[model samples]
Target: MRACFSLDTKTEAIPLVPLTPDTLASWLEAHPPRVRAWVEANGFKGKPNSLCTLPDEHGRIQGVLVGLDTEAPVWSVAGAARKLCPGTYRLDTDQDVAWLTQACIGWGLGAYRFDRYKSAEKPAPVLQLPEAVDADEVLQVVDATALVRDLVNTPAQDMMPEHLAEAARMLADAHGAVFSTVEGEALLSENFPCIHAVGRASSHAPRKVELNWGEDHHPRITLVGKGVCFDSGGLDIKPSNGMRQMKKDMGGAAHVLGLAKMIMAARLPVRLRVLIGAVENAISGDAFRPGDVLTSRKGLSIEIENTDAEGRLVLCDLLTEACEGEHKPDLLVDYATLTGAARVAVGTEIAATFTEDAPLYGELEEAATRLGDPVWRLPLHKPYRSSLESSVADIANCSSAPYGGAISAALFLQEFVDPQVPWVHFDVMAFNNRGRPGRPKGGEAMGLRAMFEVIRARFGG
Candidate 1:
């Protein structure tokens, strides 16, 4: 919860000039001879995301030049944060509110490092809060993002169902929200049989963690997250490579927690309900197996075609529970690291989004485009619903066919949701496979900002 930026207490400006390839030569001519010589000597040709530091006459830090693309994205300024020496820095040029806000966010993201278990850690260079940016808004985004990263980065041994529940409890306690859980046999008694079945094998008990906040008069929004703490693919079993980073399987739960923190911290005018189905899919004699039929909370029977498809099983029960209240939520959003097919279709950078409601999808799309958080829409094809047909149960956990796996997964989940409620499901990667200027190579928060923007736009922020 540390602040990424502070007020510029000093009067001196450590000029940060963003230059593009086309304008590099002309801009270089305006600088002093020594600065120009340094730029040439170092071969600083203003390539996008490249940085060069200039020195004063006494060999002290003077200013910095950052390379940018012609149509530079807001995060282009992140290069300065990554490359700069440990000291206070400021933007030399005046920018609009949106640009400044994004630049600040990018700077914070670039400066982030997961050193929780490290023996030593290095401090990052600080950027002064620009006058154009809203400090609270930027900090909220940064803190929420950091929370997601921290939770996902943790090893499975440390981030079990109980640990995730405790995290939810802490967040709820911090915001004065009501927090509760249904654990072990309590889940079965509560009619969350599918959730209980998937998690019953692991030593760490499976549970549903719920957090409710905001006034009764406010608009209702419910968030459901699939919390597979560690997926060893259950009895079906995943390949060794597939199970390597299975610790991040709980990323969906982490994401919802992060988003919940943001909404509560911003004090958005909406009644928020967060439900996380926390469990670990492990090997044991009691592990749920393929061909097993489990009755869901919604009273729908699902035949397990593959135990590896456990995320949907957990989410279906949670979704059913979320929609059953006296007054249904105005909007129901769920996040899950549901399918490898989503990754195959869109890769890791874009979240594969599926929603039946057009208006809600439009809002999400617009928010993502505006915030530079990418989400690609994949169909919940009605025809694919037939692919999930089972001999005994109402539906199969996975499709009989291999193609359009992501679409089929969405269709399977759509069965649990009410047709009337506006719902959006994000199949997120929740990790940056390759590090970029601002995004590091580790557990990441995908679609979080865009989703938050949609909620803010719908309800008062």
Candidate 2:
């Protein structure tokens, strides 16, 4: 269901049925005889999000009576609007007029139906916003969120490494950014050994796309996304069920690209550089196997304990390259659907963040709370460095022990990062298993908004 705020739109006033012990007394003073009778008969003791559709003598639907708890969060209105009949609805009171915009977004999010494979039974309800709310901001947020959802929902066949490069290219074209890509054997020649190793098995050649924009002198912000188009778990193959949703393995890249689009479109003043190490971890004769030793762009030799843990390998090279050029960004942030350990630590709802800089984490944490996009900061414990220690290579890509796998994974990435520079690594669960207000149950953007807010705050627009 979609909501639009316009006086021109057809809408009916919805009185919030108050929660009181004396329902009859509350009804007698506030509502008409018909409404009072209905409230008494139906036992409509006002409860949060409770709704009662008022009817006429002829039993036809007249209007809606909804209940609210004033103390609750604004998001409590989520999914409640969809329960009402499909039509334009307006608030009966003027005091909370500002809530109209937030409610509109909530209702719009509540009505999202990813009915790509099936049809929705009920039509979406429309909510009208009051004139005070900013319509343009609402539309912009919806557009960017829809972009994220659409990219995440698309299957791997349609969103492979090359296809992801096309997406990056399209965004570059839109903003007049300079776009360049390194593909196939060029990766080997260009020192992207890890990227080439992970993607060489796929029929479609993997590509690392780089897009740069804004004035060179501005505070630089580099975004690195792990774009594993489809992860088949390589030589260490996953079971059928485990590989079912591998299409969303590139959720991180999709989010970075989507956020970049929003930032560029909004004209945020940072010198932005977007790097996507797009690849497919597929199995073939040339697939890098378990126990294989590979050298990264940073010259760190990695022993592949499990080929499934290849996302970090791709990111390591891209990050190394991001730091190589003369115009290196002051801040580097990388997003990835990196490890199952992240989901285990914080679950699918929250993104796991790791950074050595406390101020960066504090700012990010505060921004996340403000934006309502939650992210939990995981530690980069120095002692966990032993978990990834390798007897043969410089380090093992996967840890020897399973405990603190998420921290070890972050520590693994820490090996490649410039210790002097500020960096935040996000292990994001890009998919939503259960639908929530403003979040649909499909491929979703987890930390995009929080990161954007932090970026904008650090380097003002």
Candidate 3:
């Protein structure tokens, strides 16, 4: 059980009462004089995320009044968990089951602390498990999310390509998934030339991890993630400021791993295959340079306009293998911290997605909306394909254009994808620059929940 939750239903705890702006006055009237006086003294308003504690004559906490917006999100009460003193809290409210479930999940999310590097001064507040929601099911999502956060939060020294492969192996072992990998020179032998080219510069050898689960007769679903362990922009190096948070370059891999966990845990009826190409875009004497043409696994000649744009290279190979050579899935989705331009367009908070298949994109949007996990779809504008064209190679990794970089980057990957396959590509930030209710300022998982819902909707769980 997660430390954030008190699963024991009979545990003694404080009552956490929720109040809306209109009901605050009525609720105060219903309470005794001491409770009303405390409320008046504190000038408590039923504003979102605001809280006021009512005390008895003995100066002990009688109950807690937490303000909530009428149409609050899943994370409405998340901040309360972080702010509350260490103790167990039981919500006393009449909200529906959905609200109850979200509140529980939100508490778990907010209570998370990355204590691997440094211990916390105190343990987080705990919320008693409500009888209304499915505890095991909700905890599965929380555990999967924690997996993503832990992997992404680790520094490059501990989270290199080889380390990531081991992590995948561990996950595979637990879930009965068959895991295998090809690293260093083995990547070349396995025909993953682009993955090798990007990761070879690092002392830590680059690797590709593949985990296969589910029976052969089920509908096939393939997931690919770009696991650039730490990107230094190679020979076309980025400025120091740009390179500061490059440890999160593998956020895409974290997301796919998390999404895969959710799918497998639910026993979704699909032949699931997870592919991650882990690499480091480091500067070295042997590093692949600007204008260098490299042959992709699909035999497409790729011209490197800038080594900074290497996530696509790591992904192109895996994407090709997933959609073309084998495991031609009913759905092929790839996630990557591929483009900064996506952040420029959609801001860091919202995930920007690109897909040529309109119907597939619709399903994704529907799932995101239904689950309150957000995603904004960007067009794979065909005209932008001209921006990636190279006279030397079949296509350049990226053009020097100052516009529509996110769209163009998606177009570059689209070239390798078989048009017959329904494909969705996510260009994500995967890190929060600022803290919010449940989202801390570190490595984060962006769209996995929505992706899981989409998978479940298409293929029965």
| lDDT score at residue 254, model 1, on the 0-100 scale | 94
**What are the Cα lDDT values of the candidates?**
0.88, 0.79, 0.88
Give one digit per residue, the lDDT tens place, for model 1 in 1-461.
25346676475657778777778788878877877899999889889888888888888888888887444355677756767777777877655777778877878887878888997755667788877678889888988999999999999989999999999999999999999999999998889998899999999999999999999989999999999999999988999999998889999999999999999999999999999999999889999999999988888889999999999999999898888978799999999999999999999999999988888889888888877788999988899889899999998999868899999999988999988989999999999989888888899999999999989988965
- On residues 33-113, what C-alpha lDDT tens digit does candidate 3 reach at each position? 877787888988888878897777788776788887455456767778889888889989988888888777777777777
Candidate 1: which pairs clash?
Answer: none
Q: List the RMSD of every prediction in angstroms.
A: 1.5, 3.4, 1.4
Ranking, lDDT, top scorer first: 1, 3, 2
Ranked by TM-score, top first:
3, 1, 2
**Residue pairs in steric clash, candidate 2?**
1-111, 5-129
Candidate 1 residues lying further than 4 Å off, grouped into runs, are 1-4, 11-13, 69-72
Superposed model 3: Cα runs more than 4 Å off: none
Q: For candidate 1, give the lDDT.
A: 0.88
Q: Better model by lDDT, 2 or 3?
A: 3
TM-score: model 3 vs. ground truth = 0.97
User: TM-scores across all candidates?
Assistant: 0.97, 0.88, 0.97
